[model samples]
Target: MPKKRQYQHLKSFKPIAPVSPALSSSSSRGSDSNAPAKGVNELLSGLRRSAAGSSSASSPHLLANGPSVHPDLRSILQIPDTPPPAPRRPVRTRFDASGRRLPAGPPPPRSWVTTRGQDVDLSHRMRGLKLKDAPSDHNALPGAYLPGRGSLIDRVLRAIASDWEFQRAYQQYHLYFLPNHLKPALLRHIGISGGGVTLADLKLILLPPTDLYEQGELEADSHTTNEVSYLDLSRSLGRSIRLRDVTNFLVPPAPQVHDTHLEDSWDAAVDATPSPPRALLPNLTHLSLALSPDDAEGGSWRHLLDFASKTSHITHLSLAYWPDPCLAPRAQTSKVTTPQGNKIYYGGTNFYSHSLDHDWSEALLVLRKLSRCFYELEYLDLTGCGSWFKALMLETEHDHVDWAVHWGKVTDLRLYAGFPRQEDMAAAEQVAFAEVMETAALVERHIRHMRAGKGRFINVERDRPAT
Candidate 1:
């Protein structure tokens, strides 16, 4: 430093200061490193400020100004743009010989094809095969697959015929109320049995008149009245009519006089009707006539008995009568005092021996005639005939000629003992009378059996006397 170092053109330089050893070292190292760091920091701060300003601006404006564009390029870009033509495909010509332009042939059919991989020839297949043309076998044997002859019609016809025949046969043995339309069929097929047909199978028959005197739709005078009109429709029967059928015919006690008189007139009307032809029922085996005790005195019983006697072929007979003790004496005592009275008595008693004062002598004559006519008699039911039946039994003086001996073949007998009112001594007398009649019937049966050379077993049934 003593020797001045010639320095060329060191103009306006600041003077260097003296440094301590520590200070010198520090000045060289620290100041040199700090100078570069300070410059780098200032440069980095300026770059950070510029980057922050640009980031805060709107993105659209920034992008717009980001790239430069020439005016010529802008005008060229603004020109009306036209899109390029679409790619062209090859044109197919119809005149082409190979037919390439025609729509691709239909896709190959999807079918299961057996290939030659199997143990058979595929190329020459069906070469020698021919479909056979043969006639079908259509001729069939009788009653083959075709349905067998149907039996429906045949079965139905048979059923109808069988049912009709059964119905017809059943009607011949029982009385019935039948419809007017069907009566002809019933009559045409009346069975061999002599008795009347049953009430069943004649459901369609007309009901009897409720009021005999009233002129109603079902009156006897009605045009519709016929054979079916006689059926008693007020009752419904189960199987067969029994003894009750006879008893039920009696008129109830109410309006007794009116009903009794009307019934008497009805009986007369029935008797007045002309008899049917003899051949109407050639097999007629039985006949039954029922009368009330009150009607016996009015001379109705005599007429009924006479009618029964005239229709002679009744083999099995049943006569039911209700007795009136009050009138019995009058009938027994009445005699022909004058010519007119003689005629009346004769007509009433039918020319029977009337000298005997008995209630049933006149009626007994008619029964005797019936017995003589029906020689093959098998059964007799003289129920409710009163003391006359007793007298018939008691008058057994003539062994073979008596009434019982006349109908000696009668095996079945039903004697209904009629008892009159028995108040005080009357009841006892009535019982005595019934017992006498019962005894007579038993004795007659016994005598008939003894004559026939057959053992007689008598069965007696007795009940309290009924009016």
Candidate 2:
């Protein structure tokens, strides 16, 4: 090593003052008479003796080794035998991410660390599958997911990747149920477009159970737009989640449900409450029901139509093919086995609605019932609806329909003229247009009556060629 700077040039070491007062007094009294005197100033004065003669500090023979005390050293003091002082350390400085030096300050508050983030998972809200092995199809909805078996999502992700790749893959993975736990994450992943999600995107979302989800909070665009959430609750029953629970988060357009067979849910929705309106979705304004005309007269189908007739808040109504399949020409019809093992037929015993002429299907009767039930309806969407213009004109002569009431409040009436095959389309189109013109005349007549010849109150729209 190099030369020790001023560290080696010290007088010979001596013992410190004794800790025991009695021993110290006795030692001092004895050292004066027997041993050589060891004083502090004498040691220092002697060590500096050579230093005073040298013109420079680079002297090897800096200290003298002897017991002789300096006689001229007055003001002597006791020097304790201890190691030299430790070298001083440089002060540390902190800097921000932008390389700006931070000033000294106290540590951050505990709340800053403990506060929950947007990504903080609500363990209780998420329900995971209990598969013992990896599933064949990761995207497929699990047949069943039991509780208290640990998080299925986490277990599966860990099995496929290491810790570094874990969370990244989780963001990319497709979950079965749209968990309320990841709403913010989902919105971020999908991104915001327009002001909110359009009707097209609403069909793509996998709605979670009714109990766990909140409607208003789940609005994709954070605005009360017509972003309808459609759910098929026909397969789920007896679970903790009920259909009514789906209404908790409803926005302007209520969530659509496909549970046509459930009569109690239908009754519950329309039945009036004593105080706070017993309707599941109190703010519900739009509803689309999938119906089939073939069901028994006194069954759930009738009950659903009845319930729908009494509905008041729903201003926009759409008759759709949700609960049942579209009425397309087929060779054979499907059969359903009931709970009591009784097999109900589709084409054999059921009344199938199919015709080449202007014979309206029995299902179209729902439209008349809807018009009667929802007298104050503002919008009636029949874009995806089946045909009934011809039947409406034909039935008026037999049944006395209050035409003013049906077409009076209606501002937007979309009519779908479903034509038959290519061979008869020319003839069918001519008939359909004629019937449409006839229907328009009637709507105009009712409007004129309601307005007392002031102005028109309706827009009759037929199938326009898709761009």
Candidate 3:
């Protein structure tokens, strides 16, 4: 009776081979009326005894390897010793001076020197008004409230504008085109040292004389600040804007031309460029200056003028010149003399020959001086530069037969031939064809490139790609 009780409990052990519900039910149904039915306890006990005998016989072999574990336990416990390491931090695109990572956005626009402890944004607290959207009030006082028009808003502006700290903040921020009377005050604040404006590019559009006359404010505080139209004060704003016969606009103080190792190829870097000009902007990266009427060779860019009688204005002047020093020394500095015997020096891969109404050679010459000191220039916009650009191409083709003015690292060039109410521009196909041949030199000089990426070109016309 004791042995029977012990075996009865053995029936509780799980089966070695599983009897599925389907098989169990089918077997039960078929066995009825055919054979004696086995009781659940008897079947389970029999299975348990058979499994025990088999396991005992195999026990020595199984123990030789290790105690045999249930298949379920094997899967649960066995894991790869070296699972793939936790995923690493993603790669970084850029870092700040401190070497910490910077999230992607337009970089803060200040040189290390100009960026102070606070690096405050001047316009952020300017009563939530955008300068561009501010309504024009001719009747209002220039920098403060007009004597009798003392509205609440005017009073507020007077208070803010009068605050010396606020004015300095505004100048530091490069605010532009305020009341005509306010310009001199701001310029005084900006002083000889440019308003801590650290812009990457300075684009100046020399509006035609016609545009200046219409502004009517041509003489607005012109005597005090020497600024032309409202836009000329953009020296306080961008890095760029329009110039309307403004002789002494508030440009940054002239800086000594720093030696540019402006290297593109290893060879150019080894051979440094010489006679760099005094740059107005030591920190500016790119500077674009354009004259409005490109075809106005008969205007300020007059090619027929007596070189001796008239001083050459730079805006209408174009000459082929190699900015890269490696090749500059090799170029024989060519000189052209005016009737007055004053030597007009134009050599070293620079050429210019376009008729103009006024001599723009002087104005454009300023850019040549600026280019030498411009560090890290990426884009050069010569659109509306017309003949001037042609002149540059001509000069480039002379020495560096394979390239056209690949200064430092200019990559994207925007060239457009446009004049308001002027004759329609050339057909797209025509411009495309010309551009293909013109840009060939750039393609060839790209120096072992599988694809042309030295610089990209954005042409005029609505459908043309801005690549």
Candidate achieving higher lDDT, 1 or 3? 1
Encode model 3's per-residue lDDT on 40-68: one tens digit a residue. 99999999999999996666544444545
TM-score of candidate 2 to 2 decimals: 0.32
Candidates' C-alpha lDDT: 0.41, 0.41, 0.37
The weakest ten consecutive residues by lDDT in model 2 span 231-240
Candidate 1 vs. true structure, TM-score? 0.32
- Can you rank all candidates by TM-score, best first? 1, 2, 3
lDDT for 87 (candidate 1): 51
Candidate 3's C-alpha runs over 4 A off are 1-288, 294-375, 388-408, 420-467
* Per-prediction TM-score: 0.32, 0.32, 0.25
Candidate 1 ranges beyond 4 A from true positions: 1-279, 292-306, 322-364, 396-405, 418-426, 449-467
TM-score of 3: 0.25
Structural RMSD, model 2: 20.8
Q: Write the per-residue lDDT of candidate 1 for residues 55-157, one digit (tens) a residue.
A: 8563444545455566678688884323334456666455447756644644334442234334256433432231111111111111112112224532332
